[model samples]
Target: MGVFEVKGGRELKGEITPQGAKNEALQVLNAVLLTPEKVTISNIPNIRDVNKLIDLLKSLGVKIEQLNDDTYTFQADEIDIEYLTTPEFKEKGGGLRGSIMIVGPLLARFGKGYIPKPGGDKIGRRRLDTHFEGLQKLGANFEYDSNTNFYKTEAAKLKGTYMLLDEASVTGTANIVMAASMAKGKTTIYNAACEPYLQQLCNMLVNMGAKISGIGSNLLTIEGVKELHGTEHRCLPDMIEIGSFIGMAAMTNSEITIKDVHYDQLGMIPQVFSRLGITIVRRDDDLIIPKQNHYEIDQFIDGSILTVSDAPWPGFTPDLLSIVLVVATQAKGSVLVHQKMFESRLFFVDKLIDMGAQIILCDPHRATVIGLDKQVPLRGISMTSPDIRAGVALLIAALSAEGTSHIHNIEQIDRGYQYIDKRLQALGARIKRID
Candidate 1:
């Protein structure tokens, strides 16, 4: 496992560019398998999870070429469908949650798909029922082998039908939409995830000859097409990373400009940060977060305690709740961080409490952070990262603490952020990777 040695009490300054959207990259990469033509993708982040998916695609015989550092061209014309039966495929597919998405495209083009139970963050029970259930509604027969924990779906020809999703899951919606794109009839998905990631996927699919409407709405209509052709796609900048940078700037009292963030796509992120009393200046596509000595959390209009909760898109993102919790540790007032989506995400608050922050773990789902108002600086301590978001949140806390902090299991952090230590170093942050 990798570790990060972050020395605190230093301010980071300079322009830091957010990487390509990790969530979007995972969705769009799998979309390439829907077409036989060359699909070129740019702004792909060099992260572990995305790389793992790319390698999985290669193992399934997708001809992938590197156009540049952050660009790739993929052709899935010569896929080895039998490769899915190999133990090697099960091991590789089981390692990544995003690998489950490949089954959608493979099923659409090749009539059958197989995958081992996928693995990802240990935040909570991330069920695959959403993905498999949605696919089953599209005329695919779903079967599970409990002994091997493998999932298989097959259909001679998928005939689309209207269905209402139980939850507007982003990955679930993406998987279903991909399969439904090539189904035999019109498919309508109500209460679908309208996140920017899903919007990008819909737009890319439309460009590839799939007739998809309702680009930014909860209701989507896809007129099934016989085939889809490849096209170019550029992923939006990671909004989660942008939000983390905003919190980092306030916590460290640093003036940092995040470049080319695709601000409009970052729904509710800026407003949520502003609620924490942080100033965000927009210059073209960049967000300029000025240094602050002491930022204050805002109370509700009724003078109630401020509550920061995550919801579906257009609401605050759950991924950034950890960052919000960490940033609130140095702020001037108290805020309740409610992580409604994942039960175990708030479990990392004990580490912040150990760092001299005033935080009360209300439960597995909520934490009330009483800001120290910068009166007492957080002292660094050794900690282990539990998940990607929590790992980055802990890193942000370490950066603002009084002394040197050691964070173990930094591979969790690397799974999402690209060259995070190097990026922070470029911005003058005293961060090092100790492998």
Candidate 2:
């Protein structure tokens, strides 16, 4: 296992370029299986999950060539469908939750798809019934094999139909959209997840000749065609990474600038952070954050304590709730951080509380953080990462602590952030990655 030993009490300063969106990159790469033509992708993040997906694609006979460090050329001209059923492929697919999406595209184009139980951040119960439900609505038949815990889908020809998802699950919506893009007729998806990542997937489909209306809204109308031709598309900048950087700068009292942010796509993230008294100045494609005193938590009109919560897109994302919780530890007043989407996400607060943070874990879903306001610096301590987002949160806490801190199980952090130690080192943060 890898570990990050962070020497704390350093103000991170410098310009850091955000990497491509991990969520968007996974869906876009899987979409390559929908066509035989060459697809060139730029700004790809070099993360573990993406490398695993790339290896999975290579095993399936997708020819991937590296044009440069952050660009790749992919051609799924002669995919070996049998490769997907092997133990190696199944094990790789089981490591990434997003890999389940390949089942839809493979089923739509090749008549059948097989997938093992998917794996990801163990934050809560992630149901694949939504994916199967949406695909079933589009004429796909699903079968589960108890012997291997594998799910298979088969459909001779998928016919478009209207689907109202049980919940606006992000990956579920992406799966159905990719499958429906090559179906027989028009497909209307209601109550869909319209996060920026999903919107990028929709836009990529449009670029590939699939007709998708309502790019950034819940109601998406996709007019399925016989086939989709491959086209070159650059993945969007990662909003989650951008938000993480913002939180890092705020908590450490650092003046940093994030370059090449897709400002328009980051709908309400800036405003939401502003409620916590962190001001972000947008200059063209860059977002600049200045050092300031402790953040002030905004209150409701009735003078009640403010509650920052997550909902589907056009609302705050649950992925950033951990960053918000960590940032709130340095703020002035109390704020309720509710993560309704995931049950175990707030359980990591025990580690933060041990560092002298004034946090009250209301339950599995909510936490109240009373900020330290620069009066007391968090002392460094040894900790274990429970999940991806919480691991990053603990890393942030460790970086801002007063002494050296060791964070074990850093593979959780590597799953999302690409070369995080080096990236932070460039910004004057003393983080060393050791095995």
Candidate 3:
């Protein structure tokens, strides 16, 4: 495992170009399995998760050629279905949550697919019931083995059907969309996840000859086609990174400019951060975060602490709540950070508290952060990453600490942020990745 060592109290400054969205890239890569023709993907983030997905695809006989730093040409001309059934494949497949999505597409194209339990942030009970339910609605039969935690699905020809997802799971919505695109008739999806990543997947499918209506809305209508052809597409800039940079600039009292933000895609993030007393200036595709020495949390009406929570698209993202919680420790007033999506995400607040942050973990899902108001800079300490977003939150906390901090399990951090140390280094952040 790798660790990140950071020397704190430096104001990060400079221009940073946000990397491509990891979540969107994962879906885009999996979509390539639907066709044998060449598919060119540009603006891909070189992150750990993305690399793992690429390796898995290659192991399944997909020929991939790297065109440049952030572009790749992939042709799944031949898929080795047998390779996907191997124990090695199951192990790697189980290690990533997104790998579950391949089951639907593989089953749709190959008539049968097998997948072990998928791994990701140990946040909560992330159920695959929605995915299985949606696939079953499209005429797929599934068998599950509890001992091995393997799920197998078989369908001769998937017939499109109207399905209402119990929850708008990001990956669940993605899997159904991919499966429905090649089904026999029309598919209607209600309560779909309309996040930017989902929109990107929809657009990519449309470019591949699948007719999908209601691009950015909760209701999606898909006109199934005979088959999808290869198409070229570029991923949107990572909004999570954009939000992280915004939080970093505010906490470090730094003036940083983020480039290629895709501002329109980031619906209400800017305004959400502004509630934390951070000033953000939008310049077309770029976002500028100005330096701030003293920042106060904006309270809700009735003179109480402000509460920031997460919701589905067009709402604040759950992935960013951890970063916002860490940033709140430096603000002037108290605020409540509610992580509604996950049960255990707030447990990491103990690590932050040990660093002199005035945070009260109300429960597993909520924490109250009382700002030090620049009265105290967090003392440097050694910590281990729990998950991806929390790891980034700890990195931000370490950067704003007093002396030096060591963060272990950097692989979690690498799972999302592309070239994170290098990108933060460019912004004058003193962080190094050591093995």
Candidate 4:
């Protein structure tokens, strides 16, 4: 674990670029396992989770070549199937939640896949029922071992069929799609997640010779193919990172431009922030959040309290609600942040509350944040990050606080973000990394 000693109240000024989408990159990287040819992927985020998946693939005897700083070519000509059921895979695979995704590609190409219990942020009960359920509908026999907590799937030849997912789980949808692409007959996944990350995965698969329709919609149709070929894919800019930077700019009262955010793709994020009275100017594909002395929270048309909650795609994402809650600290008036997805995500407000922000945790899923309105800056304190998004939210709060704040357990932060301290330093913020 490491600590970030953040000296807050600095006016940051610069243009920053968001890294490649981490979620999309995870799915894309695992898709390379479906083909034996060389698959080149660009704009891959150099974060811990992505690196861990790459390392796991390397252990399976896949040929990997780093093309550049943010690109790599992976060829899965040979794989060690025996390695999947070993204790070492249990240890290494448990290191990341994305490890479960590798099972999809493995099953698609090898007719069998095994994944030990995967690990990730402990924000809530993130279930893998959707993943196994969908793959099961595709003619895969899935069994869970209670003792070792591993999921093993085997199928001689997968025959696709119709499936309506219980929830539009993003990773679950991606997993099923990768598996279904090589199955026999047609696969129809209704209520599937249609986020840009999933769309990017589908697009890349289409380029690799998979037949898929409904690129940006919830219902996806896939006609199984015998085999897939090599393809090049570039991950889009990280929308979550872009939103985090925007929140940081607002919290620190800085003028910042998040370059090439792919604004056309951000469904409701810009407008959602605008509701907090944060003026976001769109310049082509960039988003500029100017430093402001004061901004007022917008009430509902009924003059009711403003409530910013999370929903499925085309709605505000649950990932950005934490950033929105933190950014609301210095805005005028109050707003209710209903996380909806995870129960423990809003609990991070306790750290912000300790920093002197007026926030009330109404329940496991709701928090009411009263804006400080720049009347008083938050005072720094020592805290630990509980999860990935919360870690970034706390960092933003610390960077805008009145004094030096210590944030420990930043390994959670490192898993998702790439070189966060260096990126903040480039924006003229005062932050140091210490062990």
Top candidate on lDDT is 1
Worst-scoring 10-residue span by lDDT in model 3: 104-113
lDDT of 2: 0.90
lDDT (0 to 1) per candidate: 0.95, 0.90, 0.91, 0.93
Candidate 2 residue-wise lDDT at 392: 91
lDDT of 1 by residue, 1-435 (tens): 788999999988999999999999999999999999999999999999999999999999999999899999999999999999999999999998899999899999999999999999999978888888889999999999999999999999999899999999999999999999999999999989999999999999999999999889999999999999989999999999999999999999999999999989999999999999999999999999998997999999999999999998888999999999999999999999999999999999989999999999988999999999999999999999999999999999999999999999999999999999999999999998997
lDDT of 2 at 309: 95
lDDT of 3 by residue, 310-405 (tens): 999988999999989999999999999999989988888889999999998888989999999978999899999999999999999999999999
In model 3, the Cα lDDT at residue 415 comes to: 93
Off by over 4 Å in 4: none
Each candidate's TM vs. the true structure? 0.99, 0.98, 0.98, 0.99
Better of 2 and 3 by lDDT: 3
lDDT, residue 373, model 1 = 95
Better of 2 and 4 by TM-score: 4
Which residue pairs collide, candidate 2? Answer: none
lDDT (tens digit, per residue) of candidate 2 on 271-301: 8888888989999999999987667878889
Clashes of 1: 0
> lDDT score of model 3?
0.91
